[model samples]
Target: MISVRVNGQRFQVRAASIVIHDGHVLLHRAADDDYWSLPGGRVEIGEAASATVVREMKEELGEAVTCGPLVHVVENFFDIKGEPNHEIGFYFQVALSEGSPLVDKARSYSGLESDLRLMFQWHALLDLGSIDLRPAFLRNTLSTIPLVFSHVVHPGADDV
Candidate 1:
């Protein structure tokens, strides 16, 4: 909701959740997207990043989650629809609250955001390299969560 365009490029601050169970990690993607990413949303004005993660999970999954420690802070630059964009992302550890049905769901499912449908799934940590998970660095970071917080910068296509 805090997205803005500056100098013809989009800028946003996003908060994402890292939810892992068994050997799989939870991820979601818009129906039209070819890649999957963490299940969180833009950081709204006046809301803490952690709070955004909690709020997003509820709104997207219809389930309450307990926000945990900050995991990673990423300055991610990328392109969307061929338009350059910049985003600062806060990745937080999270867990579904007790008695939430989604905790044990093994198969992929759909969640709704207004009229848009989002696909949610649990992917085996060992198989992340095969998926087009965004930020690219996450393919390795998610597999071995750092003991201390980490800050990462993912260069955009032009910078590569």
Candidate 2:
């Protein structure tokens, strides 16, 4: 994991997948979290950000994905466990390979990675604002993913 603690603040580089189907987007969250986020994980040292998205999908969901173009580059500042945190996120369009059980959009799914339990769901893009999706800007931006790349900076809890 490309994560470090400096001056009591956590910094990490993350790569996430954005998978849309039938006007819905795939999202997931850890068992203990009240909000949902994209399906990917921390970028490992020496690994490309795009590769991290593919690897994380396989590791976390037991599903293979085809990584697509980079959609957004985000500088997100937030807090976790009373500690300040900063994250550099690479969001990429991705598609599940054929025969993926996770393709079902009618219901939610669950998986376990190591000791962490994860819940996966598909949420309608039109109703995104009604749910708790962190990096909060995503509620408005995801509905119209730009054709070209985009960069965003979310100040912190108060604004994002």
Candidate 3:
């Protein structure tokens, strides 16, 4: 039960990722790196939440995705050298209908036989729970807030 404290309130949220491919999530297992996480990074200065997602995906995956509504916001804290660090993460449901994904330069995962500089991989929906990830997905509520499931409401043929 790892948790974090935010502004004197204890919670846990350090990172976030939202990857959608063929109705499935895209997961990355770093070279020699354990734990499977979604493809995203930290939020930069003067960057909006929506923009951060776009930039992170481009930086890590090299794929451009159409971001939908804001999905999840998680608050977590970590202990760095006995010091507490705060991390508030936001994950969203995105549509990657454009460019192909690119892998970053590889470092640790050499034995996996991913010749690419960076390792590229995907995981099935069934395994999302078995993996150890910072932020979690495939849920209706996060951070105690109810997330509106946009995919649930599919329009008829007329809308298409």
Candidate 4:
């Protein structure tokens, strides 16, 4: 579920993914081959969202990403493992260094399939509208994005 201005208090929600590089946004195609999404997952117990982003990115893409302030937060509601639920996803600004990702001991950390075999790639921000996303989530996200921000954000939820 995305964040809402409930009585003016900013309650954080989900663990939204974000990674910007050369005007392109990193997207994740789950190993199960479901719908594509920004590279991220639910916030682990006791972990901060920003930290989660850093850890998740490092695990999924095989690179270290520098993250910035909270650019936007979307309320996400979806079916996970057959359960309907919601979360407030914080989209922090981030940057990726220039290079190809390599999975090797000398290059990075340890792990096997969960950290390696996943498929991720970049797509032009301007082309985001072509992606299929959760409708309610995207509409609310775009409507609230601060106009001054220009980082390549997702289409919020849907409309892409």
Candidate-wise lDDT, in order? 0.89, 0.89, 0.50, 0.55
Cα RMSD of predicted structure 4: 8.2
Q: If scored against the real structure, what TM-score would every candidate get?
A: 0.93, 0.93, 0.58, 0.62
Q: How many pairs collide in each candidate, listed in order?
A: 0, 0, 11, 15
**What 10-residue stretch in candidate 2 is worst by lDDT?**
141-150
- Summarize candidate 3's per-residue lDDT along 4-36 as a digit string, tens digits: 455655443323456555434565655655655
Model with the higher TM-score, candidate 1 or 3: 1
RMSD in angstroms, all models? 1.8, 2.0, 11.2, 8.2
Candidate 3 deviant stretches above 4 angstroms: 1-15, 79-84, 99-118, 136-160
Q: Candidate 2 residues 1-160, lDDT tens each?
A: 9999999999999999999887899999999999999888899999999999989888888888999999889999999889998999999999998877887889888867679999999999999999999889888888984535789898745675
**Once model 1 is optimally superposed onto the true structure by TM-score, how far is the C-alpha of residue 155 displaced, in angstroms?**
2.1
**Candidate 3, which ten residues in sequence have the lowest lDDT sum?**
104-113
For candidate 1, write residues 62-119 as lDDT tens digits. 8889999999899899889988888999999998887767766567878998888999
Model 1 alpha-carbon drift over 4 Å, by segment = 145-147, 156-160
Ranking the candidates on lDDT from highest down gives 2, 1, 4, 3
Model 4 residue 20 distance off true place after TM-score fit, in angstroms:
2.1
Clashing pairs in 1: none
- Predicted structure 1: clash tally: 0
